[model samples]
Target: MDAVLTNFANGDILAITWRPLLAGLAQTMLLSLLVIPLGAIAGLLIAALFVVSAGLARVLLMVWIDFFRAFPPLVLLIYLYFGAPLLGYEISAYAAIAVSFTLNTSSYFAEIFRAGIEGVPRGQWHAARATGMSWLQSFFVIVLPQGTRAVLPDLLSNIITITQLTALASVVSVPELLHTAQLAQATSYNVTPIIAAAVIYLALLWPLVRLMSHLDARRYSTKLSAAATQRRRRQETADE
Candidate 1:
């Protein structure tokens, strides 16, 4: 342990050893950027399906949601990356990793968004409908604004999960952060690079967590203020 600590402190982590590390970082960033938007769109669609469907469609949607929620991302990656090729359509390692992570991210984000949508009081939805707004308009303009604020924290946490999940790409040779660290350990026979890699992951994820917290706080405070104003107006009207 001391030897590993010493190597890290000495800055013995040079560019040659950093190649895989940088590659892994790149893949992590790429996967995050690609999947986040797709996940948001998928989440919205899934939420809508759950909201609007009745009977069997709702049951089927629940089953699909439960299946993805139960499935581990790594297992899904391995299946898509290694096993899918055996079935006919051969995808490269990077593509496999991207698709699997996107789908996984989508499933979880869908649930987060669904919960957010459900958080809005049913009265609010009825009020918007009473004002002649279509259900779609109410969802996009009012419900989603509120839901985005509600779900931002959970969704940001999922970003960290996806960042860690990218490491599974290493198993398929996509050469993400963990794999890079392992390679560095193999070459130097020292654990320092691996330790540094863990620190780097924390560094990358911490800012996102902090930012999401800040946003959630601001939004929640705003909502509370608006509610207070509305309550004051109601009290004044009753007195008049």
Candidate 2:
């Protein structure tokens, strides 16, 4: 066992794969940090507009969201990478992923956020307004918090999906984690790098999935309790 462990820890597996993997890991992290926040913020703004807008404006927003949401991020990345230079605009692979992720995930974020906002009780809005708060004030103060909490599990799922999509950057030669792992495996003629990368990906993502499940469970429990309380109150009132 010690010998097997020693072999796994040293030589080509450790030395050759680690540097490239680290580089890939950095790029993956950088892309994630950039895309997640921007996508979330853009989605928030669009969702707000969806709530406030009516008629033509709402239709336009829906069209935009659907158009982007329906697009595969890989296709969008391909188009941006290969199609841009034709338009006399040069773009790097990293730039392509950034743009694609931002646009595609924004649509998802917008939809999820709107769902969250709508899930909040309408009474909350009236309560805020009763205190002489403006529409915007009520949204930022009361609605946003509850809405965000309501949609957090969905948002976390999206983030996890987006994090994995970073692997798609490899198609454009972006040298992300998967890309480096592929290169390492090809050079060493060993499956170790491939296995290592798989492990790394799992290590990074499993905790997120577990957390999302926990939050979803908690949210469901809260709703169940609230419903039970409401039913109990109604029963007591009827008896009275």
Candidate 3:
């Protein structure tokens, strides 16, 4: 342990490594924050189009989503950075990472939202139509609200996923945490900065992970009680 501590303390960690690491950490956090809502907005927009009948746009969107989700993010970053130049559109590394993360994250979010919207009880849709509401009106007014609530916990979890994925931005020279850590490691010739990066990531993600757990627990509790009440009510009706 003494040897380990001595090795860890070898370099001027605070003076040299911390600044760059913090800067990288800040960049990663900002990128994650920006990506989550942007991705969600993109996802929600695609999901809204689910109301339409089958068409070229819908088919194409599904294919795009499948393509990105199936494509590895790191590889996507590489392709976006290099492939775009070949197509006569040379984007910066930051823009490439942003576009890649957004599209990748949006694909998953889109599927979740579509499932949420579709999973909404069919009876409600029928009832809304019976009440003279147009299908679109019923979808936006009735189904969407419930669907969003049902998927809220999962959406938060996906945001956590995107946060982790920001580490992959290093591939495209995004100067994020891992990249910063690598630079520090290279300069200092000590592994402490890498450890620091891990701690920083843990500190950043742990709270959000706990919150997701709490949400899952609360959701399960609510579902269980609702089910129990439903069963009791049916029993009472049958008994009477």
Candidate 4:
């Protein structure tokens, strides 16, 4: 027990490693902030285009989504960081990670958004158009909101996934939380820093997980209530 505590729960090691771990945590947060928004915006644009696109353009969009979805993010990151220099282009670690994660995650976000958008009733689009609204306006003002709300749980879950994927940035020596923890572990000759990093990750991500769960439960309840209301209406109509 003593040896275990000394190796994995040493207060001295925590004191020594806290600063670097914090710095790493900050970097991870920054990376998440950058990539998450970039991916989301890019994905929104892509999905919008996919909706409005036709023929070759739609085909190309599908190809783009499929290619990125199939491609491994780590391989993409490594290639961007290392292969860019080989092709006579210098890319920093941050830039590489930013580009790779955006490309990879945007594909996923695009699919999610596309599914959400398509799930909206077609009549809603026609009704919006009948009210003298342009397609873009209808999509942005009416259909998009409903569609997004319908898929809020999935969107939040995807965001959580993207946040976790930020740890992969460490592979390129970007000094994210896990990498910093590894460095600290090496220096302190203890597992405490790694354990601390795990705790930090849990603390950060647990809220998102909870939020997603809440959204899912609420959505399910809404559906059940709507179903019950429909059944009651049918029963009342039959009585009438």
Candidate 5:
């Protein structure tokens, strides 16, 4: 472990695989940019379906969410990469990766959105309706604003998850960071450089995680302060 850690920081190991590693990093970022929004939108729709509908729609949506969430992303990757070629639609490893990540991301995003939407106070919806807003208007005007803030931290956290998950692309022969590291290791028989790759992942994700946490804390504090001020003003008005 010490040797791996030492080799990782030595800077010599990185020189050999820099090209592939950089390419992998680009692929990973591109994949994330494509998937995150797609997943968020799909998740929002599913959350809305669960929220607004009744009976069969709700059941079906729940089942759909469950099914996808249960599906391992690697299996999905294989199916998309291998199975699609059989259907006469040949996809590159990069395209297959984007699709698999998007689908997998959609499942988790749906749940995060559902939780955030559910967290909204019931009184908010009722108040919006009292103001003559339709359900859609109320959702856009009231529910979404609050719900989005509530979910921002979770959503960003999922981005971090997606970054780590991109490593799985190695199995599909996508030249992501891990895949490149593996190739270099295979050739060099040096585990040190692979350690460097692992450090790169950690270095990339740690700051993201920290930033998200900081934002969450700041937002929560602001909300609490605002609520407290509102409550105090109401009490003063009532006393007067």
Candidate 6:
């Protein structure tokens, strides 16, 4: 019992490592902020291309998404950080992380956005066009909003996934949360810093998980209500 406390829950080690851990947390948050928006915007552009493209162009987009999505993000990061210099191109750790995460997470976000855009009713597009809206205007004003709303829960879930994935940034010694914890652990010869990092991660992500759950439930309930309304309308038409 005493050994467990000394090894995993020691107050002294926590005190020693708190500053590094906090700095690491800040770095993690910054990384998340940069990559999340980059990935989302890039993915949105990719998805928009998917909507307007077909034949060879669409095939190329598919290849791009599939290749990146299939590739391991860690290897991608390592390659960009280490192998780039070998090829005469210097890249910082943060830049490597940004590029790697954007590639990986953009593929994921592209797929999500594609799904959401497809889920929007075709009638909405037709209606918008009938009102003299250009294709781009209709897509942006009418379809995009509904599509995004329809998949808001999924988007939030993906954002949560991306946030967690920021931990992988530590692999290149970016000194994000997990990397800082590992360094502290090595120096202190104790597991408490690692445990503390875990607790911090849980603290950061647990609320997002709960919020995703709530959004998902609300989405489900809304779908059920819409279905019920449609059934009632059909029954009334039959009676009439």
Query: Each model's C-alpha lDDT?
Result: 0.80, 0.89, 0.86, 0.94, 0.83, 0.93
Q: Compose the digit string of candidate 2's lDDT tens values, residues 9-47.
A: 445576768878888888888888989998999999999
lDDT tens digits, residues 78-132, model 3? 9989999999998998788788888899988998888889889999999999999
Evaluate residue 110 in candidate 4 and report its C-alpha lDDT on the 0 to 100 scale. 94
Arrange candidates by lDDT, descending: 4, 6, 2, 3, 5, 1
Error of 1 at 129 (Å): 3.0
Clashes of 1: 0
Off by over 4 Å in 6: 227-240
TM-score of 1: 0.84
Report the candidate with higher TM-score, 2 versus 6. Answer: 6
TM-score of each: 0.84, 0.88, 0.85, 0.93, 0.83, 0.93
* Per-residue alpha-carbon lDDT of candidate 5 for residues 1-240, written as tens digits (9 for 90 to 100): 778555554456667667777787777676677767777888888888889889998888888888888899999999999999899998998788877877788878888888888889999999999999999999988998898888888989988888888888888887778888888878766776577678778888899999899988987798789999999999899788
Shift in Å, residue 137, candidate 1: 2.0
Give the worst 10-residue stretch by lDDT in candidate 2. Answer: 3-12
Q: Higher-lDDT candidate among 1 and 6?
A: 6
| Model 2 root mean square deviation, Cα atoms | 3.7
Candidate 5 — which residues are off by over 4 angstroms?
Answer: 1-11, 215-231, 238-240
lDDT by residue for model 1 (1-240), tens: 767456764366554566677777777788677777777688689988898889999999888888887898889998998898799989998778767777778888889988999898888899999999998999899888887777788888887787777777778876668887888888887777787788789899889889988877876798899999999999899788
lDDT per residue for candidate 4 within 106-194, as digits (tens), equals 99999999999999999999999999999889999999999899889988988999989999988889899999999899887899999
Q: What would the TM-score be for candidate 2 when compared with the true structure?
A: 0.88
Ten contiguous residues with the weakest lDDT in model 1? 9-18
